[model samples]
Target: MSPDGMFLVTFSIKNTSKVVGREVAQVYISDLQSLLPRPVKELKGFVKVVLQGGETKSVKIDLNHEALSFYNDGQMSWVAEKGKFEILLAASSEDIRLKNKTESSSTITWTRL
Candidate 1:
């Protein structure tokens, strides 16, 4: 996902007939640890959602300016930042299966128009 602009992706998950457990959806913005010369901004927080078994639910991931901001030259690196970001929608953090994954990368940019 682009660093400067808002990115939104929605995907669905299928819940089988297994005994109902607390179904939660989480989104993570990663790749800040290995940025060249380090990244000025760091992504935080995970959006959690709940669902039920035998049900299909949609998870939306939104990337905002505040969540993708960094510092450069004593100023916030408002642009010219790029990296691979992973948008994960999972029932739980440890469970890799029964989840969806999306990835993208782009230079950071912002505008008021």
Candidate 2:
């Protein structure tokens, strides 16, 4: 980890189906709170990539302190709090494959060194 505790977000896309075609994968990284009843932040940009069928593509998202930090004890820490994080990796921004849902929703807890 860096002094700021920033890290890279890496993901892979695999063609599970046997069908062959040009697949374009659009990956997104956003805060979980935005999907809540009362959203605190706005949607960010897209991390786009194109891949072929049966091919696996890797994507990296640079996460800084501001992007991963949360208010803790009157200060922000380099910790992605224990809550569901929204990661959208799909064919399109609005179009998502139910069976191929790439977004992972889970709590991210980090240990401070």
Candidate 3:
């Protein structure tokens, strides 16, 4: 993350076998607030990649304050809560491959442009 709070996440995958493999990478973000982790946001697309044996590849995902927005019932709007957030890279929601943390503003209002 930069001083301005923008950040990028890269997913690295390596195929160590003798044949090609196909898979989709999924990403989820959580607030890390309670005992049971709940996803606040899920990246909107499927990251389908094909890799030949012995090849390594990476996929980059960009995030801004807007990407962290959550539905605020009291305000009847979307909000990005400040503090620590966890980014999870997974094959499925139950299958996490990587985890990382970052911070954001106390409260970020979503603006359309």
Candidate 4:
């Protein structure tokens, strides 16, 4: 991922059953440490994919500046502090499948990644 928070999240899914199935791949961002109160994980982007039995497909989610930010009461705008962040891939909020880390070299402000 880039410091601008422009990242392409790609993952592959396979349907092993005999019937078609649909899955929503959700992307969430987590602030490991924050000065303000925030959710453990925030929904950023998602993709809905349907696959036939035994079929496999790839899903992609585009993450940008907005995805990496949090509402700041001090600045009255969105902000992403410079540090480590976590990216979570899940079927739902309670069902996280994968996790990865990213970092921002500088504090990312509103309208910027």
Candidate 5:
């Protein structure tokens, strides 16, 4: 847990190609306070890793509170609601591989896996 509202995201990727493979990691935050989840932030190409054939690499991404702000249509401003939020890790928007939840009111709890 962090006192300044920041979380460390770490994941691993492997390249099974015969040559160097290029990959991009995307981090997205969604507000889960309503009936349907609302996309708050879409961070694409956040981590670009080039790996040789049959290689693997570990990546770390820093997520701050500012990156979780959502546009409040009723209030006509961007805000980070003090409720449930989900963080998604994906190679692309359509390929989310992992997801975890956090709350804005207190410390965030997450597993390494």
Candidate 6:
């Protein structure tokens, strides 16, 4: 992430099989301490890739503050609190392949945008 709260997540995916296959890489975000009720993980980004036999490719998913924010009912706005967050890469929600940490050092709130 840059100093301005933007992320450029890069990872590689490979097709280990001997035949061509299709796959989708999913990105999920988790807020470690949300004041409001929220799911443990939320799907934020994804990319579909078709690889030839024994092929490998690199994928990137960009995440901004808005992607990590949750809606605050009382405030009637989206809020991204300052704290820890988890960035996950998965083939599906049931199959998380990688886990890592990121943080927001400053709080931000906005409505409809």
Pick by TM-score: which candidate is best?
6
> Which of the two, 1 or 3, has more TM-score?
3
For each of the candidates, the C-alpha root-mean-square deviation to the true structure, in angstroms, is 5.4, 8.1, 3.3, 2.1, 6.9, 1.1
Candidate models: Cα lDDT each: 0.49, 0.47, 0.72, 0.84, 0.71, 0.89
Model 3: worst 10 consecutive residues (lDDT sum):
32-41
Residue range 1-113, candidate 1, lDDT tens digits: 44345667577766676655455555544444334454332334445545566777776666564444444544434543554444444444554333232333555544422
Give lDDT: candidate 2, residue 51.
52
**Evaluation by lDDT, superior candidate among 2 and 5:** 5
Ranking by lDDT: 6, 4, 3, 5, 1, 2
In the range 34-101, model 2's lDDT, one tens digit per residue, is 32242333233346555556677666666543443343433333344433345555566667532211
Q: How would you encode candidate 4's per-residue C-alpha lDDT over 74-106 as one tens digit per residue?
A: 787788787778999999999999999887777
Q: Compared to the true structure, candidate 6 yields what TM-score? A: 0.94
Model 5 scores what on Cα lDDT?
0.71
Backbone collisions counted per model: 6, 0, 1, 0, 0, 0
Which ranges of candidate 3 are over 4 A from the true structure? 3-5, 34-46, 111-113
Candidate 3 residue pairs that clash = 82-105
The C-alpha stretches of model 1 lying farther than 4 A from their native spots are: 1-4, 18-21, 32-52, 70-80, 97-113
Error of 1 at 111 (Å): 15
Regions more than 4 Å wrong, model 4 = 111-113
Query: How far off is residue 55 in model 5, in Å?
Result: 1.0
lDDT score for residue 51 of model 4: 95
By lDDT, the better pick of 3 and 5 is 3
The C-alpha stretches of model 2 lying farther than 4 A from their native spots are 17-45, 69-113
TM-score of each: 0.52, 0.40, 0.79, 0.90, 0.75, 0.94
